[model samples]
Target: MIYLDYVSTTPLNQEVNHMYQSLLNDYFANADSLYSLGLKTSALMEKSRELTAQLLHVLPEEIIFTSGASESNSAAIKGCAFQYQNRGKHIITTAVEHSSVYQSCIQLRDVFGFEVDFISVDASGNLDLKQLEEAIRPDTILITMMYVNNEVGMVFPIEKVYQMIQKINPKIKLHVDMVQALGKMPIDLTHVDLASFSAHKIYGLKGSGVLYKKTSTSLVPLINGGQQEHQLRGGTSNTATHTMFAKTLRLALENLEQKYQYVTSLNHYIREQLTQIPDIVINTPSEHVSPYILNFSCVGYKPEVILHALEMYECYVSTKSTCSSHKSDISRTLQAMGIREDIAKSAIRISFSHHTTQDELDEFLFYLKKTLKTIKKQR
Candidate 1:
């Protein structure tokens, strides 16, 4: 099948796979053990952490390893909210964030009586800075938003937003869910205080993730056990997974420019092809969106209809975030962008990777055109 869902997860790269296997064989000892083998494993884990921090342009102590983006996000959001509950009970975020974030705010409100203000978005899924500024108040203690939206591929103006929030309330901690943007965009944590990223999104093993907390900010640990990860997260370190995460991140950074160009070419080609059809509406903006993901509505067609049609053509895609793929609710991102409900229901995401070839795009365009035609006929 043609895999067009890199936004969900990417396959492990050969180099990362080799590192994972090698580390599993040689560094199986617990990183916290006092034995010689354990000490060696601990050293390797620390080295990986240091390498990851260097890539993120932060100190090694700032990187906290977790199971995945979900865990890191949970730790960052809940950890900060709970830790600073006495200081404030209000938070700010966008309406188009992933379920891990949106749902965390919901739970925080219900469980802790914390108030959450959701900033609105425009038609291209861009958050309004004015709305965000108005949403902040003296009680607001945290502002968390995703760097790149998972489903719609819109890149938030994170640096500008961070600066704005810092100007208003320098003590208000800023957290970023950088899961989708880790490999696709540049991430320098010098400005962002708390950022979460996962390895599987960049062709590494699953269950390996990082949460960067700037030295100035402090958070309560969500997990209580061993002192691993600076006592922020518990459990013995998964040495192999950590090594593989570092390997994949290093490779992605080395090929960043090349991959960006490749994905941009693919997105442009697909946009060119879709424009000829005249029946589809590109939900994502051509100029401001990420090159790796494309979201659009198949006019006169529901997403389920087009999805079924594409499956017959052996082309795989998705309708929304993988975390909420099973839910039939209208995409919160599209809705927040002021898109009509009918168009939102018809919206689908076609995400690609640097490995995707031009020929693959040609074939996909052909099948997609055919599917659209079939969908039109049935309607």
Candidate 2:
């Protein structure tokens, strides 16, 4: 199958997989144990933490490994809310965040009595900075925004947002959900207080993720048990997953520039080819978007119908965030951008990886065009 859903999850790298198997078999000891085997396992885990910190240009103590982006986002958002609720009860975020971030904010509002302000996005999924500035109040203790939109690939101006927040209220914490942006772009954690990352999104295993919390940032423990992950997270650490995540991240960053150039070219090719098809409307903005994802609407077709048609031809794509796929409702991200309900319901996301080949893309496009023609005839 020609897989076009890298944003959902990437195939694990062969090398990382091999390393994972080896580590899982050999270092099976509990990392928190006081025994010799446990010390060695714990050492390896710390090394992974250091490597992850080096990649993000942060201290090793700042990296807290979790199950995946969902958990990391929850830990960052909810943990921050509970830890700092005494100081302030107001939080700010964008409307186009991943379900994890959006739902976490909702929980805070519903259960914890925190006031949440969801800043609006433009038609292209870009956040309104002025509106964001206006949303920030003295009680705004935290601001959570995704660095890159998962479905539409719109790249938020994170650096600019950081600067704006610092100027307005240095006390307010900024948390970024960087799962889609981690391997696809250069990430500088200089001013970012906390950011979430997933290993599976960068060709690592599915069970590993990271939450980079600056040294000064305090968070209440999401899973309280033992002293693990610097008291930010608790449980027996998965040495295999953490080590493999570091290895995969290093490999991804090593060829970052080359991959960027290659994927951007492929993205352009896909967009150009897509425009030639009648009734196709590209939703992802031409500018200020990541090259790894392309979202579009087939004017009169349901996304599920098109997806199934393409699947028969061995061409795979996605409709919305995999986390929200069980729900048949219209795309929240698209709706937040003020897109028409029909167009939003018809949107499909095609995500690319560095390993996606030109020949594969060409074949997928051929099948996609044919599938669209078939669907149109039925209509």
| Candidate 1 lDDT tens digits, 143-204 | 99999889888899888987897789887899999988888878777778899999999988
Cα-based lDDT for every prediction: 0.87, 0.90
| Worst window of 10 by summed lDDT in candidate 1 | 370-379
Over all chains combined, what TM-score does candidate 2 have?
0.98
TM-score of each model, in listed order: 0.96, 0.98
* lDDT per residue (tens digit) for residues 1-379 in model 2: 8999999999888999888899989999998899999999988989988998888888999999898999999999999999999889999999888999999999999998999999989886779999999998888999999989998988999888888888899899999999988888899888888999999998889988999999899999889877888887777787778877788899878888899999999999999988988888999989899999999998888888899999998888999988899899987789988998878888999999888998999999898888877775324
User: lDDT: which candidate is best?
Assistant: 2
lDDT of 1: 0.87
Candidate with top TM-score is 2
| Stretch of 10 with least lDDT, candidate 2 | 370-379
Error of 1 at 277 (Å): 1.4
